[model samples]
Target chain A: MIKAFIALVRRDLLLAFRHRAEWFNPLLFFGMIVTLFPLGVSPEASVLRVMAPGVIWIAVLLAGLFSLDSMFRSDFDDGALEQMVLSPYPLPLLVLAKVLAHWLVSGLPMLLMAPLLALLMTMPQDGIAMLEWTLLVGTPLLSLTGSIGVALTVGLRRGGVLLTLIVLPLYIPVLIFSTNAVSAAVAGLPMGGQLDFLLALLVLALTLAPFATAQALRISLS
Target chain B: MWNAIWVFFHKWASPRYFYRLSGAVIPWLWALTLLLLLGGLYLGLFVAPPDYQQGQSYRIIFVHVPSAWMSLFIYTFMAVLSGIYLIWNIKLADVMVRSSAMLGASFTFLALATGSLWGKPMWGAWWVWDARLTSELILLFLYLGYLALVNAIEDTRTAARAGGVLILVGVVNIPIIHYSVEWWNTLHQGATVTKLDKPSIHVSMLIPLLLMAGAFQLYYFSLVLMRARVELLEREWRSEWVREMMGRGSDG
Candidate 1:
């Protein structure tokens, strides 16, 4: 069972790697969104700095949401999901593997590229550490929870926009805590407190979301 | 003992049984709800003593507090029903979930609207991102999302199961919303009635508040039972009881 799960994970990774442009698409979208903020608003460095955390976080969240639509779309179309459900392996473990792969492909790239966007926003040097920490702890939760949304909406005809409506409200708390954590660090207040809350949220999502996603898949498949 | 309770719960999973039972009880439930609401309002509005602080405006609590309590209570009730639906493959439980979502969402909206009305006088702002208020707003979204999800799917079973899973997952937010005022730096005031220590308000005020709360509970039961009856008929149109109901309606 473990071997099959790993194999499924590797298969998804390789498939994602083969379409590398799709992987880069979200990063580009993230960057584009961040860039548009300056054009839409004043380009003053101080103004950009003030809005940086929120802009970057919102952009990353949108980018994550964009990529999440495809989390189960391909497997669902090709009967891969059905086969896995029939497989000897547990459905929840299979879902965990898929979410792990989704986090790697969609969420990790956003985290990796966040610093460059932070530079574009003229984020203070001291704030970057907390920014990175927040993204590291927070984005995976977004990916995991977002995948459940993706799974629920996977088989629907007009799912993409509805998916956003369903998922974004749920994402508000994570966004609030993460942005607050970074802002607190920028202010030189104790960062530990908000970071601890973020970690707790992450742990909570990790524990419960996969089961929810697996159940969603069952509903979609049925 | 546990198994017997499980068996009892499982027995009512049938849509036909639930449909007939809810149909039979809805009129009585509606009558009860109407009586209680009228009595509660009279006691709450005319009879209940005004608070020393806010005076007449404090009467908003009679509506706001009960709706807020109903909001949380209905979500928990929906979640429990969804759990039963998932575990027992109960069609009636699914209907209850669907009906409850609508009732819960309305109560959430009522809570927020009444909260805003109350807040304008007290807090001097129409709206604030107070923990309790914000969490309640999020609860509205959760209820909306659940309804939208079930509607989006074409298949009834799929919709029910999908909405069920979402409801269970979203259950995390309930407690967070409940405790947000305590756990975070929020603008909302802390607990008023459910404090562990001595009661916060005078007995006169507390009595109306409790009465209003009971009225809201009855209101929810009345509506849920009514909606459940409609859902039962819609889902079980071909069943014999439904045909009998249709024939009886025509005869009447």
Candidate 2:
């Protein structure tokens, strides 16, 4: 079972790796959104520094959302999902594998790119580290929770906007903790508390969200 | 005793039985609701002494508190019904969920509207991004989203299953909404009734609040049963029992 799970994860990673443009669109989109923030706000470094955490967090969130719709879409289209459901391996593990691949492709790249964006926004050095660290813990929660949304909407004819409407509110708690963590880090306050809170949220989402996502897939397949 | 309870539950699980049973109970339920609402409103508006600080405008709690309580109560009820539907795969539970969604949305709307009305008098504004208020607003959005999801899907079974899943997912937000004020520094006031040891409100105030809460419960039941009957008809239109029901209605 473990072998099958690793194989599925590896296969999804290879598929994501082969489609290089699919991987880059979210990065480019993230860069473009970060640039737009400087244009929309004043060009002053102080102002950008004040808004940096919020701006960077929102950009990463949008990039994560953009990549989410494709999580199960391609598999559903080509009958791969049906085969997976029928396979000897458990469906929930398959879902977890796909979510891991999604994080690797979409979430990790955005986290790695945060420092560069932080420099663009004139964020303090500690703030950049906090942003990267929070994303490291928080974005996986987003990916897992978001897979539930993606699975729920996969069978719909046009689910893009509806998916956003359904999922964005769920993202609010994560947004609050992640941005607050960065803010705490920037102010040189004790951030251990907020980081622990984010980790708690991540743990909670990791435990419950996959079951819900797997159930949603069953409903869609039916 | 177990057999008897099972029989009772199973009987209600039949839509026809539920429709007939609800028809018998709804008139009494409506009458109770009307009596309690009128009595509660009169006492709350005029008889109950005004607050030492906020004055007569605090009377808005007559409507607002009941609506807030109803919103939370109904969502918990809906979640339980969704759980039943998931476990039993009973079509009746699905119909109950469809019926409850509209009523839940109505109560959520009442909570928001009356909250705004109260806010204008107290906070000198119609809206504030207070934590409790924002969470309640999100609750309204969740309701609307659930309704839209169910209506968008054409297949009845698919709609029920999908809507059920959405409700289950959205249930996570309810606790967050309830505790938002306590967890965060916000403009909204803290709890008056939900405290563990003692409720903060005076007995005179608490009495009318309890009465109005009872009225809201009956109001929800009367409306949900009425709507569930209609939902049953639409879902079972092709069944023999529905044909017989239609024929009997025509003959009468």
Give the candidate number with the greatest lDDT. Answer: 2
Q: What is the lDDT of residue B20 in candidate 2?
A: 84
Interface RMSD per candidate (angstroms): 2.0, 1.8
Give the true-structure RMSD of model 2. 1.7
Stretches of candidate 2 above 4 Å error?
B176-182
Indicate the worst ten consecutive residues by lDDT in candidate 1 chain B.
B176-185
Q: Ten residues in a row with the worst lDDT in model 2 chain A?
A: A168-177
Colliding residue pairs in candidate 1: none
RMSD of each: 2.2, 1.7
lDDT of each: 0.85, 0.86
Q: Model 2, B174-220: lDDT tens per residue?
A: 67534533354478887899899999999889888888888898999
B78-98 in candidate 1: lDDT tens per residue? 999899889877787888889
